[model samples]
Target: MSAGDDGLVPDLGRGALTDRVRATVLGRRTPRAWFLALGLATLVSLLFLLGVVYVLSVGVGAFGLNIPVAWGFPIINTIWWIGIAHAGTLISAVLWLTRQDWRASISRSAEAMAMFAIVLAGSYPLLHLGRPWLAYYLLPYPNLMDLWPQWRSPLVWDFFAIASYLLFTASFLYLSLLPDLASLRDGARRRFQQLFYGVLALGWRNSARHWARYEQAHRVLAVIAAPIVVSVTGTISLDLAVSIVPGFHFTIFPPYFVAGALYSGFATVAIIAIILRGLFGFRDLITRAHLNRLGIMMLCFVLVVDYAYLQEIFTAFYTGEAFYRGVYFDRWTGPYAPYYWGMILCNVVLAQGLWFRRLRESVPGLLSLAVIADIGMWLERFQIVITSTHKDYMPSAWDTVRPTAWDWLTYAGSIGVFFVLLLLFIRLMPSVSMHDMRALLHRRREGGHG
Candidate 1:
């Protein structure tokens, strides 16, 4: 973990570190690159807003939902987003608990990604609900009507899981921002700037007692967040695992889902880190060392996911369950065969390149792998969700799951939502956690890893 010749963060003192972080937010003029990116994101977001309006006006008929394949792109997008969100908590909370100093460089962006992705994921539940206005009925508050939510349902589980995760992620992001906000307020050049960040800082005096409380709270939150990351995905998998459908009924789902989640989540974090490193000039902060570590993590999860794939196939063959066996065969040989093989190539075959130190450290190599893995993860979700439901136990009821224009539009637009939120986050505040980076610098000065 030593910095060696390639440190994760630039060896800067307190003043330089503060200036480096503060300049990202408080710069008098916006960069042309930022303006262009924001314009594109805003345009896509506007289209997304239009798509939502269309969906609301036209109803669920706008999507492609047939008899056997009721769930379409919405479910796929929901699960994909959820998987992406999982990496944030794992990187932020789990790494902090394990004392990985490299995390300090990327945790803020990762956590912000998770929080934004959660909102995107959460929207699917409402959007997919035919009567979206009646979504409040999912909540189990006392009412005059005797009707209540079915506690045993997976949908209900999803509601609580997503809700709980949102609360935890929001609190974690806000609490961690307090110290930075206080610094920004103190260094404000204008009265408006001081007032703006001052209110957001929540009046932190940074006393010894306050620092002690912050540390205690952060530790507890990290502990709480670790389980939430594991449990939320497990609960989401229950939606499929509990089903009696052939591919859906497998016992390997929970672990597989979690592995898949981390797999794609790490890829997404890498994508964001790499893009922002260039766009925001964080080459020193988000260094190649950090990218290499991320690549290694992605490779580790690739092995886990590959093992789970083998297990799913092996279990089917061992159990001699014709339904499960057929599902596995159909996955690689059926109409979705291309997707399955593409997933294998992208996730398993191509990902093996990371075993080499050179490739892991290469910018284009890491970026290519990250993008390919993200596509593969989406395909993984598509195969798992669609293949299972499109052809169930009854052969007569089998049908193809095709997405309409609206389905494609809405899904693409959700990506817009993620970018818009992320771009705004980077623009408005110190995207990098200044306090944590300072700590990292301190650690390195003390002859430790950062």
Candidate 2:
């Protein structure tokens, strides 16, 4: 069997795969679509600047941080972006460990997405703090005022959790890019391009010793990253679980949050993979088989999420706690009923399309559903935060909350930043893992394309 037989990388060989990926970064002229998307993202990203300026000058009062619902769009967007980041790291680390060949085609881009998404996610926590300059207070620093982060606070937990994930993600992304950077350094036609890539590559000779050491370092990094998939979000879940509120207090939050994060993260990876595959003419590399496998992975998570939902409802009733029962009731029929139902349909009901071979194989169908699932995930976060916080144990604390224009602007701006980072990544590096693809080619020659 050849590479093309199993519908992976068709007509694969070292020279062809290297040339195809290198051209994306080293080419003189970039695609028009890249320019248009970057321009739009840049424009929208300015909204972040405007919102920050207003908040800094006018204080956090410029936005809609009301009494009952203090955590609004900013918190919601933060959680959503963090979940997206997890998907990339999870895919790259787990798939590589399990020896999945399809991961070779998408792992580079996925890791890049994780890094950029986490960077964007980091911005919200500070921005949500009205006095953004005082953000360093979250850190455990020795000070004359004797102020330190409360050891038991979930906010403090979140700070360390995000910091840890970001560090690992950056290391993982850099390790994966070393070989490709070396490729760019050698293949560059311009003097500046050679210098740039050379500095990034750190003088790689591609010797046997280099390959052996690189593989060892890569494995160690993967080992360190594997546990983060469970730990980071589990820490985030603590932010809600420790609270005395009805909907927020639940034992299932840790696993539920992790399952939802991976579910949404995989959908995001699919959407980006589909776009990049189409734009760069990487049809053979990111084949239907890859998409099929991704769909099945998402289906497994969908069943897990459904079970989580059932557990939440059952536990609420079985425990017979009015606060928990009332919160769930409001979640189903409260002011945000549309968001609740929309989340269910998009994530649970509509995702049923993945069960069919024809729909899963259809690029357009999966793309549309992936996008919907992404939105559904965001809604899930929104419902979880708002329903629990909006109406507390006391009736007097109940208040309706809505995001103001500034809130929306900040949210939109974070999205802009995410896309700008993603677009730059697409333009500056090989979106596919080259060395991994070479291994795939070798395996295919030995009749192991399956």
Candidate 3:
């Protein structure tokens, strides 16, 4: 209560603020365990190379496609991966805008995943081109003959969506990274590391003026990123919505894609969080409170998506459209009925159980459920892509397109490659947002003592 205590408060604040909190590139002790982890990840990446070789040598038919279903797994997998990336920007950008303190610990990794997964997803389009080379024809250029993209096409819309979203996410990630880069620049024992971090720090001296600008730039980027992410998913839906296919065409496609995006994105977040928490032993920072909050988000999206599902059926039956009803019935009662029902059970019913406290509180339990939800969401995208492609207004055009062993191999390998990248990131980089996290800890301590 005295003036003396007030003066000492600033001293205490500065003392509690440690450099260890901000820098995550490496700690005091480097371990043998880290290298072993990297070696294992390198092996997983090689498996992905095998899939790449198979796809390249055998052709697109290796994955199995007949006529109308020419697009197949490529488009669906692209959207699914991109959708799974949405939560990164959502957590970092939108939560930052709302001043959510929880973001301090989670945002860095979330943004990292967003950038990496987006890059991963972007590769599929080139693979789908089959030639893989000369795929740049899709891009617009000023030539003597007047070369330009077909702006009227949804595929064109997808190109723009992925490109813009990736750029925006990169900017957002780098902007957040500047302060941390400065910490590394200051702490470096090596000249090359110093030079690398120094340039990125942009001569940041951490003055009060610089701090103000840092906060402002982060907020402005978040404001822009939130809508860009939503639009990206919406454009994916447009690819299906613009189609005349009975199963694929619907007014609900945009919202449906967005919901599916959130669902899978959160699952991706959950699995990543579980691994990071265990590997880094960051139990205090990324606590059960965060898990519960994420669970709630996952549940909300599933319900919204389930509602969309109901409406799709209602519109079909309610309008008495013969083709719509027949397709709807065929989708549910058809050979793929197992997949449809499984999606409902895993995405909807299983996610709803997160309402129970014990389930959210359990680590292994929650991760298992998160994996289930991710699988269910993938099935949702697959159902949308394949079923609709095969069947449409014209019944004669319809034929089942079965996935070959190569199709299954590529899907599984993509997931392995994703984890391999994530494990390396956790080891090489700071897994938590040290600056933001310290800011939060200081605030909490101040509030508690007062």
Candidate order, lDDT descending: 1, 2, 3
- lDDT of every predicted structure (CA atoms): 0.88, 0.86, 0.77
lDDT of 1 at 424: 90
Rank order by TM-score, top first? 1, 2, 3
What's the lDDT for residue 429 in model 2? 86
Q: Write the per-residue lDDT of candidate 3 for residues 170-286, one digit (tens) a residue.
A: 898888877777777877777887887788789989888998988888778978987876899999899889988787778998988898898888878887887766766666567
- Residue-pair clashes per candidate: 0, 0, 0
Cα lDDT of candidate 1 equals 0.88
Q: In candidate 2, which residue ranges exceed 4 Å CA deviation?
A: 446-450
Itemize residue pairs with steric clashes in candidate 1: none
- What is the Å distance of residue 170 in model 3 from its true position? 0.8
- What CA RMSD would you report for each candidate? 1.7, 1.8, 4.3
Error of 3 at 90 (Å): 0.4
Encode model 2's per-residue lDDT on 1-450: one tens digit a residue.
544666766576788889889999999878888899899999999998899888889877777778788888778888888888887987888778888777889899889989988888888888888787888898888999988789889989999999999999999999889988999898998999999999999998888899889989989887777889888888988998998888889999999998888888888889888978877888888988888877887888877887998999999899998888888899999998999999999888998888987877889988987888789889999998888899888889899887789988988887888889899998898898887788778787766642
lDDT of 3 at 249: 73
Segments in model 1 whose C-alpha atoms lie over 4 Å from true places: 1-6, 447-450
